[model samples]
Structures are given as C-alpha cells and as structure tokens.
Target: MRVTELSFEGFRNLHPGRWNPDGGVNILYGDNAQGKTNLLEACWLFTGGRSFRGAKDSELVQFGADYAKLGMTFEAGGREQEATITIRQRRSVTLNGVSLPSSAKLAGTFCGVVFSPAHLSLIKDGPEGRRRFIDSAYCQLKPAYVGALTDYQKALTQRNAFLKQSKELGRCDSELLDLWDHTLAASAARLTAARQRYIHRLQPIAAEIYNGLSSGREDFAIGWDSPIAEAILPEMAAQWLDALRQARRADLAVGFSTAGPHREDLTVTIQGQAAKAYGSQGQQRSAVLALKLAEATLLQEVTGEKPVAFLDDVMSELDTSRQDYILNHIEGWQVFITCCEPSTALKNTAAKVFSVKQGVINE
Candidate 1:
C-alpha cells in the first residue's frame, strides 16, 4: 500500500497541514517535540489501531480544537482509495464515502506497520508486549482475528471475576466454574493455534532478517511458549479444559484464572541465549528491527502490496552500517523515518525530506 496524500487538522500539537509524500523513502527531520512523530502517527491511524504511542483518542485533538480530523488518499488493491478519521468523542471512519461500522473495519483496506523506541519493550519487557506484537501483526491481515482476541479477553475477565467472588465468599461454584472452563477452553484453544501458526510462518523470516542485520554474526529464533500442547482444535480445547479443571483450586487460591492464553509468551533468543537477559543494546535493537521488517515482508507476501513502514527515530540509535541498511538498503516499500537530525547515511540517497518546526512542516 502507498499513501498518495495525507492531511490532518487539530491533531495533537500539530498545526493544520497537508502532505503529498513520495512513493520512495520520506524523511521527517526536526528537533525534539516538533511534531515529527505526530505526522507518522497520523498516517498510522488509518490502520485502525490505537496510537502506537499509547495516547487516548481525546489526546489526539489539539488544546483549543474540538476535534482532530485526518484524511488519506492511498493506493491499494490496485486502485486509488480514500479514508478519513474524525476524532471527537471517539474515532469515526469513512472509507471511499462509505461509513464503516468502526475504525477496526479499516483493517485490510489500508494497512501499515510502525516501530518506535517503545518497541524495545518487545525484547526488554515481559511476555505481554511480545504477545501484543505478534497478534497485532496478524490482525492487520485478518481483521476477524481481532474478534477472537476480544472473545478470549472477555471470557478470561468473566472467569477471573468469578474466581475472585468465590474466594471472597468462601464458597465454591463448581457449575459456574465448569461453564467458564468450557468457554475459556474454546477461545484459548483457537487463539493459541492461530498464534502458533503465525509464529511458524514468522520465525524463519525473522531469523533470516536478524542474521542479515547482524552480518551473520548472531543467530536469532523465536517461539510461542504456550501451555496447551495439542495441535488440533478439539484436542487442544480438551487439553485446556482438563488443565483448567486441574488448576481450579490453585486459581481460586490466587483469586484469578491461572491457566490460559493470557499467560502465554513469545520467546526470543539471540546466539542461543535469551535476548532480554544477555543481548547487547545494539543486538536488541536489531532484533526488533528484524521482526518489524519481517512483518512488512509478510504483509506484502500476503497482500501482493507492500505495507508502508513508519520508523520513528530509529536511525539515531543505530550504528553507521545499520543506519545505512535502514536508509538505503531496504527495497520496494514506502518508508517514513523520523530523526532529530539527518545523518551521513542519508548522503547520496534519493529521498524526499520534510523538516518540521513548531508543528509546521516544510518540504
């Protein structure tokens, strides 16, 4: 997918503006807090996800404005298409003049992937971040997967609440627990199978990319760490249902549901060691980049079009060689990269450059 034109008004600290970004690399350079990242955020919002920076919807509106409106003219599915998002009480979307049920419906129609400094948490933090990374990557291609995720979360919440009530009342509801067990079993089984399949597809590509980024000096591998072992849905759900029954007393003791997909993790290793514990800072950064690039590659493989890449302040931390790889080596995708200042790696490179100052953008 390519963005032919993007425009926004009353978005965050940015002044109202319009941009027609080039099909090749587009660089957004400026000092800190000058709306460089905000521009990328605006483009990414068309993907129907929340702010990559974790900002609330209301936070996207400027201080004096009542709402933030964003519009995009993009090329996807072999034709030019349009989408708009208006953020007031919440985000409302219109795609090619057809109002969508919700922003999530924009998935598959306009797709992109983003990477920010916070993505370091995918390696340095706990399992939740890694799980979110894999799921978010898949949800972009199959929007229905998001429904599975929501269903799993809802069932988990109900089961945990019931667990808490039982603990407080000093009473057991075996029948209620059984009902939750069956519900959790189905949702967890389906989600786990989907995640494992995604990892099977992702692991080899990520490993190859990481090896290339590290100049073949380090080996990279990732896997799903899940409790349910069976591969088929019926068998896996049976496995989980039995596990939940077995774990009920322990779960009650802790006032929460103890065994399910929520507790699963994505395991990442570099040079046969846990990247989180032993990898160097550069290695960690490279690992995340490999994964992000793998996401873009797979999106292209599935959709027959390259998804735009938003790399926020990524080059500043990378060494010269890695910087060159990002600035000049990646092929065939529209890339938007932000930095505090341009680097030598950008020298002799053909790219459209935009400078941001005090919320205004200059071409």
Candidate 2:
C-alpha cells in the first residue's frame, strides 16, 4: 500500500498542511521536537491503532485546539481509497466515504506497520512486549484472529478478577472456577495456536534478514514458548484445560494467571544466546529492524499488498551501512522514516525528502 496524500490540522505540533509523499521513500527530517515524529504519528493513526508513542487522544490535539483532524489518500488492492479521522475524546473514522463505528474498525481496511524507538523494547523488555509485537502484527493479517484474541483477553480478564477475589475470600469456588478455566482454556487454545503459526512463519524470514543485516556473522532465531507443546495443536483446548487445572493452586496463590498465552513469551536468540541477555546495543537494534522488516514482508505475503512502513526516529545511532541497509531491504515498499538530520546522500534521487520545523513541512 502507498499513501499519496496526508493532511493534518490541530494534530500535535504540526501546522495545518498536506504532504504528498513519494511512493518509495519519504524522509521527514528536522531537529528534536520539531514535529518530524508527529508527522509520522499522524500517518500511523490511519493504521487504526493507538498512538505508537503511547499518547492519549486528548494529547494529540494542539494546546489551543479542541480536536485534531487527519486525512489520507492511499492506493491498495488495485484501487485508490480515501480515509479521514476526526479526533476528540475518541477517534471518529470514515473510509471511502463510509462511516465506521470506531477507528478500530479500520484495522484491515487501511493497514500500516510502525517501528518506533520504543519498539527497541521488544527485545530489551519482558515477555509482554514480545507477545504484543506478534499479536499486533498478526491482527492485521487475519481479522478473525482479532476475535480470538479479544475472546481470550476477555476471558483472561474475568479469570484473573475471580482469582483476585478468591484470594481475598481465602477459599475458591470450585464449580465456578472449573467453568471459568474451561472457557479460558478454549480461548487460549485458539489464540495460542494462531500465535504459534505466526511465529513459525516469522522466524525464517526474520533470521534471513538478520543474516543480511549482520553479513552472516550472527544467527537470529525466533520461537514461540508455550506451556503446552506444539505437537498437539488440535487438542490444545483439552491440554490447556488440564494445564490450567494443574496450575490453579499456584495461580490462586499469585492472584492471577500462572500459565497460558498471557504468560507465554517469544524467545529471540542470536548465535544460540538470548538477544536480550547477550546482544550488544547495535546487535539489539539490528535485531529489532530485522523483526520489523520481516513483519512487513509477512504482511505482504499474506495480504498481497505491502503495508506502508513508519520508521520513527529509526535512523539514529546506527552505522552508515546499517542505515542504508534498512532502505535497501525495503526497496519496493513505501516508507516514512524520521530522523534529525537527513543528508541528501541518505537517499537517492527518486526518494523524497521533506524538511520539518516547528510543525511545518516543506518538500
């Protein structure tokens, strides 16, 4: 997919103007806090996800403005489409002139993948971050997976709330707990199986890219580590039910889930050592880039349309060769990358460079 036109009003610090980015690479460069990242964030909002920077809806509007308005025109699936978002207390969305109940409804309709500085936490942080990384990408590829994930999360929430209350009561309701456990396990099976398959597809592609990024000096691998093994995917519900029963005591002791999808993690390794534990700063950054690029590749393979890439402040702290590799690896994909200083040498003649300063953009 490629974005042809993007306009924003009262969005963060950006001025009310439209930017027509090149289909290849569009670099938004300026000093820190000059709205470069904000420009990317505005484009990323079309992905139907919340702020990648973790900002709230109210925070997206300028200080004197009561709301934010964002609009974009893009081509995908052999056709051109237009989308607009009006942000107040919540995001109101319109796609192809049809209104959507919520911005979340725009997930599969208009898709994009984002890799921000915070995404480095996918490797440095705990398991939750890795799980989120996989699930978020997977959700775009398969819409049904969204229902499975929602069901699992809802059931997990109820189960945890019961666990907390049971702990307070000093005694559990066995019958009620049994029903809840079965419900939770069923949803967990569906969600976990989907996660496993995603990781299986993601691993090889990511490893290959990491090899290219490292010049074959390092070996990168990804694995889905679950409480139940992969050999019995069809019987996962029953197996998960048993596992939940077995872990009930420990779970109640902790007043939350002790095992299952929520507790599971994606194990990332480089040369047989956990990247989080053994990789250097540059190695970790390259690993993240490989994973994100692999995510974009997977999206294209499954959906037949390459999702736009938003790399916010991703060029910082990388070597010259690696910085160029990020562009080389995604030659055909539409990219919006942010950096403080984007010298003309960073991109070829075909690529577009936009100067951003004090919320203004000039190409």
Candidate 3:
C-alpha cells in the first residue's frame, strides 16, 4: 500500500497543509521537537492503530486547538481509497465518505508497520512490550482477533472486580464466580489460540532475518508462555476453566484474577538464553530490527499488498552497516523516514527529501 496524499489540520505542531510524498523513500529532516515525529504519527493513525508513541487523543491536538483532523488517500489492493479521522471530544472515522461505527473497522484497509524509538523497549523492557508488538501486528492481519481481545479484556476486568468484592466481604458466591469463569475461559481460549498461531508464524521469519543480520552467528527463537497447553480450542477452554477454579482461592486472596492470557508473555531467546535479560544493547537492537522486518514481510504475505513502513529517526540509532542493510532491504514498500540529517547513502538514491522548521514542511 502507498499513501498518495495526506493532509493535516490542528495536529500537533504540523502546519495546516497537504503532502504528496514520493512512492519510494521520502525523508523528513528536522531538529528535535520540531514536529518530525508528529507527521509520522498522523500516517500511523490512518492505519487504525493507536499512537505508536502512546499519546492520548486529547494530547494530539495542537496547542490552543480543540480538535485535530487528518485525511489520507492511499492505494491498496489495486485500488484507491480515502480515510478521514477527526478527534474532538471523541474520535470519528470515515472511509469513502461513509462513517464507520468503530475505528477497529479501519484495520487492513491501509496496513502498515511502524519503527520508532519506543520500539527499543520491545527488547529491553518487560514482557508487556513484546505482547503488544505481537498483538498489534496480529490485529491488523485478522480483525476478528480484535473482538476476541476486547471480549477477553472485558471479562477479565469484571472477574477482577468480583474477586476484589469477594475479598472485601469475606464471602464469595460460587455461582457468580462460575459465570465469569466460563466467560473468561471462552475468550481466553480464543485469544491464546490466536497468539500461539501468530508466534508460530513469526518465529521462522524472525529467525532467518536475525541470522542474516548477525551473519549466522546468533540463533533466535520465539515462544508463547501460556497456562493452557491443549491444542484444540474446546480442550483449551475446558483447561482454562479448570485452572481458574483451582486458582480461585489464591486469586481471592490477592483480589485479582491471576490466571489468563493477560498475564501471559512472549519469550525471545538468543543462543538459548533469554534476550530480555541477557542480550547486549547491540544484540537487542538487532533482534528488534529483525522482528520489525519480519512483521512487514508477514503483513505483505498475508494481505498480498506490501504495508507502508514508517521509520521514525531509527536510522540514527544504528551503525553504518546496519543502516545500509535496512535501506537496501526496503525496496518495494513506501517508506517515510524522519531523521536529523539525511544520510549520504540516501542522497545517492532516488529519495524525496523534505526539510521541516517549526511547523512548516518544505520539499
């Protein structure tokens, strides 16, 4: 997919204007806090994903502005389509002039992958980061996964509230707890199956990319950590319900439901050791890079259209060899790169360069 036109108004520090980017590499260069990342954030929002930077909708509006509006025209699946997002007291999304009931409907319409400074946490931070990485990618490829995730989260929340209330009252209602347990088990089983399948598909691709990036010196593995080990969905649901019953006493003591997909994690290992605790800075970055590249490839293979790539000043964080490898690798996909200085390698390529100062963008 390629974004042919993008327009923004009252969005962060970006000037109210439209951008027609090159279908190949388009580099946006500017100093820190000059709205370089804001431009990319707009593009990411068009893809139905939450802010890669984790900014709230209220925080995305410009200073003194009450709302933000973004419009995008892109080509995907051999056709041209338009998407519009308006953020005020709430968010409203429209595709092809028809209003959408929920933004989740926008997934797969214009798929893309993002690489920002925050992504480094996927390797160095806790398991929540890795879980989010996998879920985000999987949701785009399979929109039904979003419903399963939402259902599971809702059931988990209700179950926890019941646990807390039971602990406070010193008595628990077995029938009420059974209701929540059944609901949680059903949703959890679906979510666990989806997550396990996603990790299974991602492992080989990520391993190959890591091996190439590391010159076959490092071995990479990805695994899903879950309490339900049954391969069949019905059996998994039964096992989850049994596990929840067994953990009720401990969960009540703690005032929370502690056994479900919400507590699960994704394990990344290098040379048979956990990467999060043992990998060096360089190794961690390499692993993250491989994972991202693999994500882009998987999206294309599943959708039959290459997802747009947003590189938010990540090139500056890599060495010359790694940078060269990335630039050489992303050939067919439309890439929007933000950096302080346009690298010499990019200057020699067919890249469209833009300079940003304050809120203005000039090509």
Candidate 4:
C-alpha cells in the first residue's frame, strides 16, 4: 500500500498542509522541533488509527485546539482509496466519511512501516514493547491476527480481574475463575501460536537483512518465548489451563494473573548471545532496522502489497553503508523520510523534496 496524498489539520505544531509524495523517496527536511515528524505521524494514524509515537489521539490535536483531522489517499493493487479520521476530546472517529463505532473498527485498511530513534531500544527495552512491535507488524498482514489479539486482551483483562477480586476476599469464586481460566488459556494459546509462526517466518529474513547491514559481523536470530511452538496449539491450551489452575493460589496472592501469552517475549540473539545484554548500541539499531525492513518484505509476501515506509530520523542513526543500503536498495515502495538537515545522502536519487520550518512547508 502506498500513500499518494496526505492532508492534516490542527495536528501538533503543523498548521495545515497537503502533500503529494513520490512513490520512491519523499524527503521532508527541516530544523529540529519543526513539524516534520508530526506530518509522518499523521500518515501512520491512517494505517492503524493510532500514533506510532505512543501519543493519545486527543494529544495529536494542537495546543489550544479541540480537534484534529486527517485525510489520506492511498493506492493498493492499482486501486485508490480515500480515508479520513477525526480526533476530538470526547467524540467518535469517522472512517471513509462515516462514523466508526470503535477503535477496533479501524483495522486492516492500510499497512505501513515506521522508524524512529526510540526503536533503538527495541533490543534493550522490556518484553512488552517487543511483543507489541512484532504483534503490530504482523497484525497488518492478517486481520484475523488483530481479532485474535483483541480477544486475547479481553480475556486477559477478565482473568486478571477475577484473580484480583478473589485475592482481595481471601477466597475465590471457583466457578467464575474456572470459566475465565479456560477462556484466557484458549485465547492465549491462539495468540502464542500465531506469534510463533510469525517469528519462524520472520527470523530468516531478519537474519539476512541484518547480515547485509552489519557486513556479517553479527549473526542475528529471533525466537518466540512461548510455552508451545507451532506444532500444538490445542494441546498447549489444555496445558495452560492446568497450569493456571495449579498457580491459582500464587496468582491470588499476587493479585494478578500470570504465565500466558500476555507475559510472553521475543528473544533476540547476536552471535549466540542475548542481544539485550550483549549487543552494542549500534548493533541494536542495525538489528532493529533489519527487523523492520524484514517486516516490510514479509508484508509484501503475504499481501502482495508493499507498505509505504515512514522513516522518522532513521537514516541519521545508521552508518554510511547501512544508510546507503536503505536509499539505494529500496524498491518501488513509497517512502516518507524526515531529516533535521539536508545531506548528499539522497542527492543521487530522484526525489520530491519539501522544506519544512515552523509547521510551514515549501514544496
């Protein structure tokens, strides 16, 4: 999927602007703290109806403003689409000019790959972030995956509530707890299996891209830390139910449910050592970039569609060869890049360059 045009209003420091991007490389260059990143963030909202920077929907509205609006046109498989999203303090969202009943209603329409400086922490950060990273990327490829995730989260919440309440009373509603246990375990098993399958498919691609970026100095590997692998989803579900029953007392004492896909993690290794502990800063950045690029490739393979790339200050963080690799090797996929200063990094390519300053742009 490629964004052909974008329009934003009252979003962050951006005033209002309409953009037509190159299908290859589209660069938005400006000084630091300008509205460049805000522009890219608006585009990301169309993909998942959420901010990649972890900002709340209302937070996207400009200071002293009450609302923000986003309208984007994209092309997928030679078909064109126009989507609009409106954000307000206490209001619903409109998709395609109609009101969406829930945020979950905004899934699977657009696919994108976003990069920022914060992604460098993917290797070092806690497991929750990494799981979200993988889950979000894979969810775009399969809508069912998103549905499964939603179900799992709902079940997890119910289970946790049961455990919390049971612990507070010093006695449990065994019947209700049993129902939630089975529900949570079943949903967790499905989620774990999907995650494992994705990791298995993603590892080789990530390894190849990482090797290219690191000049084979690092051997990168990725694995899912799930109790059950791809071979047995149902059996694992049954096992998890048993485990949940056995751990009920401890769970109640802690006032929370534990040990399921909600607590699962992704393990990254470099040269057979844990990257979280052993990899250098530069290695983590390269590995994360490779992982993202692999995600773009995986999306293409699954959907026969290439996701548009919205890179936020990513090139600035990479070495010369890796930067060159991204600029030179990227194919027909549309890319929106934000950089603080102009450089010869993109001079060799044909691009549509926009100068941004103080939320205004000269195209």
Tens-digit per-residue lDDT, 1-363, candidate 1: 899999999998888878999998888999999999999999999988888999899888999899999999999999999999999997789999999989988878888878899889999998988898889888866768989999999999999999999999999889978999999999999899999988989999899888777777889999899877847899999999988999998999999988889889999899899999998988999999989888888878888888888999888777787777665446678989898878878644788888999999998
Full-model lDDT for every candidate = 0.88, 0.88, 0.89, 0.81
TM-score of each: 0.94, 0.94, 0.92, 0.90
What ranges in model 3 sit over 4 Å off? 175-179
TM-score between candidate 2 and the true structure: 0.94
Q: Which pairs clash in model 1?
A: none
Please identify model 2 stretches exceeding 4 Å from their true place: 343-345
Residue pair clashes in candidate 4: none
Write the residue-wise lDDT of candidate 3 on 1-363 in tens digits. 999999999999999999999999999998988888999999999888789899999999998998999999999879899999999988999999999987667888888888887888998888788788888879877877878889999999999999999999999998999999999999999989999999889999999888876767889988999888948999899999999999999999999998888888988899999998999877788788889989888988888888899999777756666676677778888999999998877676689999988978999
Q: For model 4, what is the C-alpha lDDT against the true structure? A: 0.81
TM-score between candidate 1 and the true structure: 0.94
Record all residue pairs in model 3 with backbone atoms less than 3 Å apart, i.e. clashing: none
Worst 10 residues of 2 by lDDT: 342-351
